[model samples]
Target: VELILIDESLHLQNGIEAILTMVEENPEILDDYHFVENIRQSIIDAVELELNYLKTKFGGTTIFGVSYGELERYMKYIADRRLIELGFNPQFGIDQNPLKFLQKEDVKKLTNFFEVTPTEYTNF
Candidate 1:
């Protein structure tokens, strides 16, 4: 299982779509009408639980975190902590880089200093 948290629901939908593309090509995972609606409801409920817990623990202060990673293991730790804080489980998957499909020099100019290609750099 993987838990993905985003500020906006649409962004979460997009990320889930992209992740499903890499994980067995199951269109069922991306269907909001068929699947996501129910899942989303549960996630929202869980998030509320987490928010209430945080409010009680921190006197209603906003929660924020920063993390960096170059590997799945480390990324998972960061992702897990954040998602668990939101009352969800973490799911592991590669980060998708839409830039890889680009033929333009935009990605090269931006990522020239790094040894890995745009797709590789986007993993983080």
Candidate 2:
């Protein structure tokens, strides 16, 4: 079974939203200017490497890749909304999501917990 992480999946997006909410609530916890950028670059590098390996092993297969900037924009949108919900203003001026194809119905379907089943467990 293949485990896929979709761009608009609530599990992934909500985690990011929570983190940004935390940061906004307690700005002193993260003082580094490059913190978010570093984390974003690391995720981009890791995903690109994994996707490249998959492309090499499974030749002729089309692979869809999301850029670090695109992912950041989506996460920023979620974060901004979350901040507003928490009675705080949005720090990031991202007015739109980069991945516009992920509609509300798609998110609803993707986030349906009953539709997901764990195939295997791996200790992180």
Candidate 3:
């Protein structure tokens, strides 16, 4: 199983109804940093608990880790050390121009550059 460390900031969108959208879609986005951390911790606990139970039955030897420090804690607690750190290499600037969504794991986020069509008029 792949461990996904979802970045909360990645979800925010800069739009006229940003706050309203946040409230409707994910109220968690408005939560304070500490409160959000608590939620993440609980999620980590649940995954560890499930992994512990599964290990007893099948004894699999692999951990795709997104957080090494936290994963080490659970690994020690459960006494399993077959962790493999998932790598994230985000490319910026011109370095990312060559990459595409169809490409490999290491990605370069491309800046969207497009022309907007001239509108005849603006209406409310």
Which one wins on TM-score? 2
For candidate 1, write residues 1-124 as lDDT tens digits: 0112222333544655564564346655554464644554555465556545554655534333311222223334434444454334554433342223221322233333366564423435
lDDT of model 1, residue 82: 40
CA shift at 107, candidate 1, in angstroms? 16
lDDT of 3 by residue, 1-96 (tens): 001211211231232145455546887664566644544454456557865775665444444422343333433432211111111121111222
Task: Give the per-residue lDDT digits (tens) of candidate 2, residues 1-124.
Answer: 1234343354656866787788788887566658655655544465556556555654654336655456556656755555455445665677676777654433443434567663332322
Model 3 scores what on Cα lDDT? Answer: 0.35
**Candidate 3: where are CA atoms >4 Å away?**
1-31, 59-124
Worst 10 residues of 3 by lDDT: 79-88
Q: Each candidate: what lDDT?
A: 0.41, 0.56, 0.35
The lDDT-based order of candidates, best leading, equals 2, 1, 3
Model 1 — TM-score against the truth? 0.28
Better of 1 and 2 by lDDT: 2
The local lDDT score (0 to 100) that residue 2 gets in candidate 2 is 21
